[model samples]
Target: MFLNHSREVLRLLTSLQADLLILEENELLFFNYFFSFLSSVLGLSITIWIWMLNKKQNRRKDRIYKQLSGTNALLIIWVILMIISRFGSILPIVLFGTPGYDNHLNLYEEYWILFVLIPIVVFMQSWFTVRLVYQAGRWIFSTFLLCMLTAFVLQLTTTVSQEKLNLAYHQRFERDYNYIDQEIRIAKEKYGIDYSEQTVEILKKQVTESSVKQVESVKKAFFGDRPVTLDTIILQKIIIRNYKEGGRYYYKRNAIENWRYALPIDILKQLSYFDQNAKETKELLEVLKEMIDLVNTPEIHWQEYQNFTETERRRSLGARYNIPDPLIEQLKKVQTRLLEDDLYSDFFKNLQAIKDRE
Candidate 1:
């Protein structure tokens, strides 16, 4: 009966480890279950193995005492190393609250360390076997339990660290978004940027529109159970950074300028069905893309890159965002014509000139 129980537990551990190895990618469901099972086995086996080894050592005066002393020394070193490595990982989660999915994988990848316990347990049982009074023939049983306990503690630590970090990251995003929205509202009020009643009504209608919902429903119909999160919105910031880094200031500035315009591109598309010019919308997007090549072709300036980085650093430090000097000069030229009642004809003419040259 005892042997059957041990065999069943060993079989279970083997199956879990196999699932872990085959998954190739980290899925939280499998990771949690595998670690839980491994931990329980280690805790049980360690206590039994230690008690049996201590009993055997009591009988033999010379050899058992020397061996036990050596084992104790090795165990102390093993535990100290484990603490140093693990505590270093958990400290950041505790301090900064930036626990991420990556951190979880990093903490638990040290799973192979449990195998070391196997050799230690076998050596203890062997010392007793040589003395010819080995009543407890459960070396395998003890080793498996010891492995489970070690795994349990490590898995627990990782789960706690990851949970802490995820909460922190989510809260940080919400806080920052709320603060930026408030700042925008304050700027709008200070500038006295009031709109007509009809314009305000259109804006309200856009807000109530379900364009995003319709697109998502279409996507879900084709792609089953795909998850989406704030990461999607965060990707736009990454795209903006990429454009700046590549010195595509014309594209980057125009994209940012869109945010300051009458309505967002998506909302404009929805509003287009009601008096919005299709040709103008197409021309705007076309101009945005063409400006990228024009800016890159006219020789990317080092000062523009320097100013872009400086602006980014200041914004991160909570400064008001501003267009860099090089882009500001282009805007000044465009605005000068607008003030002169040129009706942006010069802007289109210059863009045409660049296109003709290309």
Candidate 2:
């Protein structure tokens, strides 16, 4: 009888856990939709380029081409649908821009005009390129030939370069995401962010504000006060660290990967856009400094010392005077405040109102 009651309790716990996960999973969907959209963009771009390059209109080849016509249609349709899906995916956020499941998109809208233009351009380019390919030896329209050749080369280079860039981009994206995830695990386990319900607007503002100021500081240091040569050296170091450290600390990657963007966090909080007196500001400046150090080093990851908590637990509160007891907890409380803010709710409510009006 006791075992049966225990089983029921465990089952209830599981269900409750799943329900909570489902609730929190909304933020994660943006990454999914974006990654899918990027994949489609890259895939369609490559397909269109290939079709444009290979097309020919000779009679015998046409007959042979008819057999492969289904393949071409399939490819074209795939590209078109993917494009449409991506466009459809982004519309909710940019237009009405709701949050959560009904939102069905991201709060931070990422736009690409190429999504609409590519399909139309693809078909047109395919038609023209087919004619050009067949007339390579003959004199086709001079402008048509020039345009065709240029499109051909441009398409080839763009597809190749985009793939390489996306490759680097995704690698860094995943790396930084994992890095943030690692930190979150620390935040939850060692600190107490996971337990807090106070996560909301002020928290978001803090992170966003911090990041923007950090970037702005770097920009000013490089372009405003420091010489171009000095900035170039810093940029070179950043690039080298990106390559060497697998980008554990880079900004475009690490900074963006943060679940809570420091820029918007700072913005919402109305923190100083720039800290004029970094030397004097102790509490706030220290946090900013850690972030800046992370950005600059581009290699050093914030790692919680293994057995840190365990070691802490072994001692009494005042048993260890050297280590600060509240520092770890203080850091975690700050993190929690960032996560559970009411800002998104207010933002979403306003957006939905506008959407309803429309």
Candidate 3:
């Protein structure tokens, strides 16, 4: 009998809790709809009030108010709309937390009635009101509207044409083939090494193959197509040239003066392309892999040390003060290896010699 009574009490409590939750949810939903409706109404009212005020001022016999043109009225309404749209949601979020799920619908659908439809209606109203109130000729008004539309179309066309021309220029003469051309030009001018058309064609083919391979590799790893960005394309080109001509070519021919100073992140990212089985490529890749690891490795492990005040640290030379960063230690060893290794040292010396002669 006592067990049956306890079970009944538990079921009642659960049912009451569920009812409370449902009530709270319904209240939240109601508030959301109410706020959205209120906001929409407020925006529409403000727009209509502005239109009315502009009309009243323009109708005044006083020269100051009479001088208010239709363009000036339109500009005023535009400024008001911009301000409201920009700042309307900020106050609500600060005071009432996040808006309802329907807030987007309110913004996109309900607010369109306020922002687009009302403004358009206001604009047409102002247009006809100005004409009627001022007793302006219909022919003059029609000509003014036609002229504005024509100027807007012309400006849009010019902007679009300029953008297309810039895109074409970048594609044809500045991106892929142009890098090879510049390399050829530099060799011809500096070393008197003239490449024939056949040589150029071969170089272009090699670059195309390298670029396609790199793009595919990236897509396979990331599960996406190559990102349409100039920096990504340029980095891939640099990697291709570095791989084909040997890593030393970048240090010798490219503006990068030191192998150590080259972007470790870029080298680490492209490390998979360098064959670790090959003797020539192994050392550079190994060094770059170490550098990337060191970059990500923390300088200090704070959790290893006991928590102590600044004053405590000043008095005691303990484990905290004695701890040496592993990254710094590893970096020193890598630097020594780079300086001593013939693969890097000899190439750098030759580059320095060439620069000295130049």
For every candidate in turn, the CA RMSD to the true structure comes to 15.9, 22.3, 23.3
User: Model 2 — which ten-residue stretch has the worst lDDT?
Assistant: 349-358
lDDT of 2 at 1: 22
Per-model TM-score, in order, reads 0.35, 0.21, 0.26
Candidate 2 per-residue lDDT, tens place, 46-72, comes to 554455445454676664554354355
lDDT of 3 by residue, 1-358 (tens): 2222332233233222121001134333333333333333333334433644554443345334333444445554566556654444342333212211112223433444454444344345445444534554774456445534543443333221123333443343234366667756855675455767754543443223333344344323322232223223333333333222211223332222222222433433343344444432443444344333323333233563355432233223212222124433444455445447654454333221111101
Candidate 3 structure lDDT: 0.37
Off by over 4 Å in 3: 1-123, 130-328, 338-345, 348-358
lDDT of 1 by residue, 133-161 (tens): 34345754564565556556655554422
Model 2: residues >4 Å from true position, as ranges?
1-24, 58-196, 199-305, 310-358
Which one wins on TM-score?
A: 1
Query: lDDT, candidate 2, residue 107?
Result: 40
**lDDT of each candidate versus the true structure:** 0.35, 0.33, 0.37
What TM-score would you give candidate 1 relative to the actual structure? Answer: 0.35
